[model samples]
Target: MLEEKGIKPAVVAGLSLGEYSAFVKANVLSFKEAVQLVKKRGQYMTDAVPLGKGAMSAIMGLDRQTIKDACEEASILGVVSPANYNMPGQIAIAGIKEAVEKAGEILLEKGAKRVVPLQVSGPFHTQLLEPASIQLKEAITAISVHEPTLPVVSNTIAEVFKDKEQIKDMMVKQVMSPVYWEDSVRTMIDLGVDTFIEVGPGKTLSSFIKKIDKTVTILNVENEKTLEKTMKKLAELEA
Candidate 1:
């Protein structure tokens, strides 16, 4: 579909399972390989953490440091830490159920507009997910990963991973580290990428990209209808 539309991505990045898709799109690995890796990631994440013991929450209208301070003050018996730094004032925290609950309470006390708990199988992108990282590392290292044709930012550091080895290491660490998505979007903007095309099952990334930078042209392709619209947009943009 991308080829049919002549929509060449100048900078492609992804989140969580979307990372594997980005790799496939970048031609670093085949789609089959990427799917297999996601299966492994899903299995490892589920098996490493017990159900209902882990949780996630979004703390809106708070700075990163304030959220960090809140998490530290709210830590109870289990692990809790910031997971996804979505945008300037939005961040997702993840860890033990009790810890997340405690953190939410602290955020509310801090005058945060909203603290909403997320439905997830595990406390993703936190220390609690380290075991899954270790397991996934072995599988990822076995695959033949190459440098991306376009700049592909790492969720772990919000920087473009230039080397294959660095990409491997960062991929493992990303399982247990916060995704600096806000920083990533800014970085791409600094690099002069004024357009973002999100191709996947959901429109979540496109929404975040718009929230991060409304001035940039954002197109999301999931179904055939959206694909056709995106093709038309690409033609107009290139013309």
Candidate 2:
């Protein structure tokens, strides 16, 4: 739709699984290859950790460093770490079930306003997913990748991917690395991205972007109504 309307983004980025969409949009991976790769990737991740062994939770009303420290403190019990820095006060932690539970308690004790456990299949973006990362590396090695037409910011380093040869490695590592969402958004803002249009099913990303920079224009298109609304809004902006 953006193409039909002659709308071009200054930069492109995605969060976690959303990165694959960015890759497809950037022409780095074909639709077929992306589907095959994502299927195997999902399997590898599901097999990496047994059901009921791993868990994830959202930590609200806490700073990044404090959450990191809480995870580090909880690590003594088992694997636990900050998984997603979603926004200023919203972060996700993932690891062994026991450790995650412990971390949740610690976070609340440290003055966190709330700690809610997430309903996820397993602990993602933690060292426990390293096995999945390894498998993903092997799966992607057989596929061909091209340099992105537009820069795709990585969740691992919060940097633009410049080397085509490194894309595979970045994707693999991304499976086990915390998503630097806030940092990635800040990087785009630094590059002068004043408008963000999330092309997905939910408004979760838009909410996060708003928290990061409320002054920026944010829009999401999930259906025809939203699409029309967003197009009208963009026309107004352009006018």
Task: Please report the candidate that would top lDDT against the real structure.
Answer: 2
**Can you write out model 1's per-residue Cα lDDT over 1-239, one digit (the tens) per residue?**
88665657887788866777778878877888888888898999898789999999999998888899888887865789999998767899999999899999989998888998897888999998889999999999778888878778777787887887888888788888888888888888998988888887888778888889989999878889999898888789989
TM-score of each: 0.95, 0.98
lDDT of 2 at 8: 77
lDDT score, candidate 1 = 0.85
Q: Could you give me the TM-score of model 1 versus the true structure?
A: 0.95
Off by over 4 Å in 2: none
RMSD of 1: 1.4
* lDDT per residue as tens, model 2, 88-167: 99999999999999999999999999999999999999999999999998898899999999989988899899877778
lDDT comparing candidate 2 with the true structure: 0.92
Candidate 1: misplaced stretches above 4 Å? none
- In order, what lDDT does every prediction score? 0.85, 0.92
